[model samples]
Target: MNYEEARAYLDSRVSYEKRGMPESTELRLDRMVTLLEAIGSPHADFPIIHVAGTKGKGTTSTMIASMLTGTGRKVALHTSPHFERVEERAVISGEPIPGDRFTRLVEEIASVVEEIDAKLAPDQPGLTFFEITIALAMLYFSREQVDAAVVEVGMGGRLDSTNVVIPVVSVITSISFDHTNRLGNTLAAIAREKAGIIKTGRPVVSGVVKEEPASVIREVCRHLHAPLREAGPDFVDQYHSKGLAGGRVEVSTWRRSWPPLDVALPGRHQGANIALAAATCDTLEELGWTLPTEQLKQGLRLCRVPGRIETIRRHPLVITDVAHNEASASALVAAIPSRPEIPPSSPSPPRVLIFGSSVDKDWRAMLAILLPHFSHAILARYVAHGRAVEPSTMVEDASRAGIPVLTAETPARAWEEALRLAGTTEEPQEPASSDLDVAPLPDEPMICITGSFFLVAEMRTMMPLAEASVRPISS
Candidate 1:
């Protein structure tokens, strides 16, 4: 089968809601591993860093991959819930493999899957979308012989297909209430699900510092005989200072100490992510993957993740982040540069938020958490699935929050409204600066495109940011 045919084959499978649990469709999935084994367990070829978390896993994974790549290792990255392209989930050398390459790989895997199908009994479902992608990434990584791979678990870790591998180090970034319908509601329960990646005797590194959930991870590590390196105490030491280019940072870890290190990403969460990445590097060192310090540092400085505090323009700058859950929304709100407090000659751009999300999400809670930062907001509907909170209802939620909200039937229309409102005014205003000094917003109004991951995916296609993908950059 060719690429198009392979995509069709995968697309013909059930949706997330339709498929529900893998076990329900167990009869259909027997050949997934069989197919992989037939192809030679490519996942076993490389040292893997498995990451699982509700909020910060993506950032943490990106940081670890950046550090490894900086060290000149050919690294493979597989992150889920792609913002734009399906190929975004799998990256080689920091670049998204093209549609042609992805299609070709899927075709190859499909051929093997077809061959193994006869062995499966009836009433069983076949591989789902994620399973196929995971298969492709592992097969591709193994075939290319990558030095290391950074994997972000697609969903709850235990049943997650990515759990099939034995990783060198398992990293759980931070845990919070999310996917309550699937992963559970309480922090400890969520922690248990995230802790599933803890393999017996494998080293697990985590940034969890709170009480209930962090305690849960500790318990699992003890049970598994896995050494759990705590994020702050055992691995990372924090330092902060002012910088000329961006902000100054201090990162002290079990491996090394870099006080007043300059980091580009904004917010305290980023500081945590950096620390986690450092801890990850330390864990790798123990396993004999000693990378040069310069590369790690340079890689940290150079790493750029889009749709998560991505700056699009200057002067009314358009800062976009893909923060959907409560914890994530809180972080995004905290990161928005507040207009200067000091009296100035000029005024700041109004903070306009353009939000959208799946219908099942806790939109009320998510919107409430971010009410402080949004001077004005608009809600957009889902473009992919019809089951999204309507923009009109979102306006009602905003009204209760005492924040004015505009609405659009679809996100594409919402984008135009947000733009107009962000720059909209009955009259013009001036600019200003301050000494106690919060960072400044850019020339254009900041548009935070968030809610459903699918909405952000659509936004990237409709309104492209400067440039970001899995593809590597050339000098």
Candidate 2:
């Protein structure tokens, strides 16, 4: 198929998300393994590092990939919930694969779609956007003959589409409640799902997880005879700092030096993520893989994971984040710079927000976590894609949080309103022809773009070429 036709066909694959795994993907590993076998065993082409967790998986995956690249290894990476294209899910040597190569790879993958489908028979759920993306990464990595590949679990580690591979070392960053309807309800149950990545006899690295959940993971490690090294228990973060742009942490384990580590992504959560990445690096050391300390530090400092507390423009300093869950929203709030320090001469501008979310999230709880951070909040729905909750209902939910809010037809217009309020010179001052026309104010107020990952995904499409590098904080 041609490129546009291939893109359209890929878009059709999104419908498979509705076929939610009724049981944990971990329990169905046998089936996932069989599926891999039918595909010519793509997982065996190179060494892979499998990572899982709720919050830090994406960040940790990037850190690990960045570190591997430091050693001059050509690496292929696969992570999910793409803020842009399915192609963004696959990266080689810290850069996304080019579109022309991506389309050609997809065409090759599509050619095998019929064969893989027939192999599954009744067990087939059809290839999902994520599954197809993983297949692409495997195919691309094999074609490129990279030294190693770092793969993040698409969801819960065990049954996640990426779980079919046998990784060199497994890393579980941390576990928390997020995909409750799909993963599980409680923290322990969720940890159980993430623990699915642990392979027998493989050494695992972990970070600070809640007690109950850690206990669940501990039980699994014990059962699997998996050697596990935990961040706080086996290693600890010696120093932590927060700054206007972001912060750094110095980690000290038995083997690692007290090195200052920078994470371009905002949040205290990232300190934990860096420590997890450091610990994974230590695990790689045990496997005899060498990493350059200077390059590793550079990766964390310069690494850009879009939309995760990413700044869009200056003057008013517009920021965007894809913090959708309660824990993450709380982190986003803390990560927002104190209004006072942002502008030394200019008077502080009250926080204004353009927020949206999907139906998968707890509307009330997510709003409660973020509402207080803003003086004015505009509630909108991410209607362009699946799982969007209505904007009107979000406005109602924001009201329950006792915050002043307005509903918008779409996140795009909501963003326009936010900039108009900021009065940024780079933006159009007047509202477009629509049911709403927010008065354009001075471009001094700090505005944030947040809510669903899909919302952030759409926002990136509207970005200028220079703004394309910024994306939601992802693994």
Candidate 3:
């Protein structure tokens, strides 16, 4: 099958990321196991670094893979919820699987997938889009003889398809409230779900600092006899400074201290992620992996995750981040360049926001956190996804928060409106009663497009040629 045909085959399956997740009772791992067994269990061919958390899992996974690659070992990195292409979910040595190779891989596995589908029991669910993708990634990595693979759990760890592998070192980043309906709402409950990746006698590196969740992870580690390396007590990261460009951080562990490292991803929260990646590397070293300190620093400095306060344009700086939850939204807000000081005579440059979110997310709470930082917001729905929350549904919330709002049918239209407003030189005005009041447009305004991955992906496709050519920094 060709590339388009392969994409169609995968898209035809049940996808929780595209459609909303079903009840937690319906989640099962038997199908994933059966599918892997039929395909020779490729996940067992290499050492794996399994990562799971509510936030920063992708960044942590990328950092670990880059560090492994910097040591001259072939590494495979698999992440989910692709921004532009499905191939982004699978990478070998810093490059996405080529289109022809992806097509061939899918074709090779197509018969087995069909056979598995044909034998499902009445109560059993079919293979999902996520499961297929994880299988394909493992198969590709095994075929290439990768030294290691860093796999990010698609969601909560216990039932996630990526959890099948017993990793060399399991890394759990900051735990926060996300997918609360599927995972439990309390911190301890969520921590238990995320801690499911901790295997017997394996070491774990965690960034959870809160006692409620940290205690859960600790208890699990104790019961399983897994070595636990907590963030605050085992290792620490210090945030030196931040700017629109990026941030500077220094990480220290019991093994050694590294010089201050420059990170391409911004946000004070990234300090914790960097520390988690460093500590995971340390644990890998303890497991007899050869990773020089300088090479580790090179990986930390070069690794970058797209859509994490990523600046796509310069003049009137335009940023896009996939911040769907309150914790991530708070981080995105904190990372935005603080309003510049202006003379008493000049008005502060307006901060324009283009926002959208999924139906299951707490969009109102997100808007409450984000709207205050901007002069006004342009709301739109992500056209490609069916789970987008209606833009009109958020108008009352924005009005209640005393922020002007404008609605658009699609993300492209929202960008157009933001550019039109940004180009205008108008004085700030008092809040008006109408819902569509976009009155205050200032000269040389900065824009932030955020709220959902789908929205950010759509906005990214509309970027000018110059901005679109800027690649993410990694190995």
Candidate 4:
């Protein structure tokens, strides 16, 4: 079987992330367990770093993997909700597995996956796309004999398929109210599901700061006898400053202190993520893994998370961030350059937003945080996954909230309209026409494209040669 055929088969299965997981039903881990056992339990072959949280887990996982690889060890990284292609979820030493190898791994597991599906109980759904994908990652890691693997939890941790591995150190980035319908409605409740990744005697590092969620995590760690290291009190990061490019900060942990660090990912919150990565590396040291301090610093400086607050253009300042929830929306809001911050003598560029969101997100809440900051918003739908909330629905919500919002049939239209509307003093700019005559604004405006990862993926196609790194496109 070829890569295209393998992807087609995987896409045919149900996806819990795109379609919400069944409410109030226990996630069926039996299928994943059976499939793994039949495939020789490849996850047991290497040490694993399991990461879970409402947000920032992907960044933290990528950071840890980069550190491990910097020490000259072959590392495997498994993350979820890929921006552009399915292969982005499974990568080795910063490169995705080869197409031929990905295809072969899928073919190797196809028989076992089908056998497990046939034996599922009547009310239960069979193995999901995420489960099969993670199984494939573990099998590939075993085949390559990686020194370590960093696995990010798909959603809530207790029943997540990636939870099958008992990691050397489990890291939870931050607990927030996302996927509330499936995870929980309250902070403490959501933290409980996240805390499920903590195993007995395994050290756990958490970046959760709020008292409610932190309390839940503490309780879970106590019950499981897992050593707990909190981020703020145990390993603190002093954020000196930040910009659209990245930030500078100093990370101090219980083990030792490192000089000021440069993180390539934008947003001030990444300082805390860097701290989490540093703390996890300290834990790995206790486990007898040797990562020199210089190597860890090298990894922190060179790491670049692709779509999180990614700047794709400079002239009009086009940026794409995959911040889909209210908490993350606030982070994106904080990262944007405010007009007031510019010296009064200098011209401040107006911020214009092009937005799209999934059906399951708190779009109203997210808009509440993001809209007021932008001069105006161009609302659009991400149709790539068929999961976006309708653009018309966003228009109504923005109207009810007394915000200026314009509708676009698609993300590309929204991008064009934002470019056209930026720096204009006009009230409520209309949708753009192909040949509309308008003068460029005297000062360039910053255009932010955000809402869902799917939207970012679509925007990537429209980026110019200098804007994006060239890579193989999955057909």
Instruction: Return the lDDT, model 1, position 274.
Output: 83
* Model 2 whole-model lDDT (C-alpha atoms): 0.72
lDDT of each structure? 0.73, 0.72, 0.84, 0.81
TM-scores for every candidate against the unseen true structure: 0.88, 0.89, 0.94, 0.91
lDDT of candidate 1 over 276-351, digit per residue (tens)? 8888887788888777777788777777676666554434455567787888888777666654464466565667
Tens-place lDDT per residue, model 2, 366-387, is 7888887777788776656556
Between which residue pairs do clashes occur in model 4? none
Query: What residue runs in model 1 are displaced by over 4 Å at the alpha carbon?
Result: 1-3, 15-32, 115-122, 237-246, 342-348, 424-444, 467-475
Off by over 4 Å in 4: 24-26, 340-350, 400-403, 423-442, 465-475
Models sorted by TM-score, best on top: 3, 4, 2, 1
Model 3: lDDT to the true structure: 0.84
Is 1 or 4 the stronger prediction by TM-score? 4
**Residue 129 miss distance in model 4 (angstroms):** 0.8
lDDT per residue, candidate 4, 291-357, as tens digits?
Answer: 8988777776677677788766555666788999988999998876665455678866767788898
Model 1 accuracy (lDDT, Cα): 0.73
lDDT-superior candidate, 3 or 4: 3
C-alpha RMSD for every candidate: 4.3, 5.5, 5.7, 5.5
